[model samples]
Target: MKKIGIIGGMSWQSTQTYYKAINEGVNDHLGGLHSAELLMYSVDFAPIEQLQHNHQWPQLANKLSHAAQSLERAGADCIVIATNTMHKVADVMQENISIPIIHIADAVAVKLKQKGIDTVGLLGTAFTMEQDFYRQRLQDKHGIKVLIPDAPHRTCIHEVIYKELCHGHVYPDSHLAFMRIINELHFSGAQGIILGCTEIGLLVSQSDTDIALFDTTFIHAQAAVEFALS
Candidate 1:
């Protein structure tokens, strides 16, 4: 198996899920003591969050680029950025690394298509919801339609992600709020929901609602495992 590199800790909470899921996936596929070959460079989320708030994407890109290079030098065969919002800088990260960057959205798109889901409701940081990179990729590359919560709901989702979920705090009220949003999206023709933020699965899951839920963290990790095995 190839060594999968991870740029993680855009909040250590969700990175933990990526680590666990990747190993579990590999074990499930190979059986008997098998686990992923992983090299992870976990960064402090505080400064990166601050840079995002200040619209310093170039600086954030530089930081992630450095992290990717470190993983490459450490003998990683490919890279996975653990957080969804940080993928805004994926291009920069890829430019600085020689190995493939397994994009979270592409993994998600593949799953959506496999489930015959044409339209999906996305929940993530404001950057991911309001920006075009992720949405356009799904639409253009995968022929999937993406739906987002309204402006007020978008703000609430963003707040819950950074303030609560990223810090490992999952409030019951926040859980209900997300459910309401998902139901609304379902009414608006979303065939499924994309837990676009990696931390979102910590708050909500497939059991929370009847709608199909795509957990990006799990999908992305599984994709990494498949790439490694291939």
Candidate 2:
């Protein structure tokens, strides 16, 4: 099996989920004692968050690029950033690495297309939601329509992600609020809601809404496992 490299720690909460899910997925598929072969470079998220708030993407890209190079040297066959928002700088990071970067947006879009989903509600950090770099890629490259919540709702969701979910706190009240947002998307023509933030599945899930739920965390991990096994 090829070794998968993960650049995680945007929040340890979701990173841990990735670790457990990837291993469980591999074991379930192969049976017995099989588990994912992986290496992780968990960065201190404080600096990354600082860079984001300050709009210092160049520095952020340098950080991830260095992490990617280190993982490449350590024998990772391919790379996974393991976070959604950080992917704003994924290109800069991947350009210097020899291994393939399994981009989360591409992975999610592929899964959506295979299921015949053309439009999906996308919820994530404000950056991922509003940025053309991420949304346009899915639209222009994959022929997918990306739906984002409106201004006030967008702020609410972004706050919940950082203040609660990423902080390792899960509140029922927050899920209730998230459910309303999911329904808004459904009523607005979304057939499914993309859990675009890596940590979002830790909060809201398919049970929260009747609409189909596309969990990016699961989709991205499944893609990694397929690449590893191939």
Best model per lDDT: 1
Q: CA shift at 44, candidate 1, in angstroms?
A: 0.6
Native-structure RMSD, model 1: 0.7
TM-score of 2: 0.98
> How big is the RMSD of model 2?
0.9
lDDT of 1 by residue, 1-230 (tens): 99999989988998999999999999999999999999999998899999999989999999999999999999999999999988998988888889999999999998999999999999999999999989988999999999999999999999999999988999999999999999999999999999999999999999888899999999999999999999
Quantify all predictions' global Cα lDDT against the true fold.
0.94, 0.90
Per-residue CA lDDT of candidate 2, range 78-172, in tens?
99999999889988887898789999999999888888999889999999999987898899999999999999989988999888887989998
- Using all chains and alpha carbons, the TM-scores for the candidates as numbered come to 0.98, 0.98
**All models, RMSD in angstroms:** 0.7, 0.9
Tell me the lDDT of candidate 2. 0.90
Q: Distance (Å) between predicted and true CA of 160, model 1?
A: 0.4
Instruction: Report the error of model 2 at residue 176, Å.
Output: 1.2
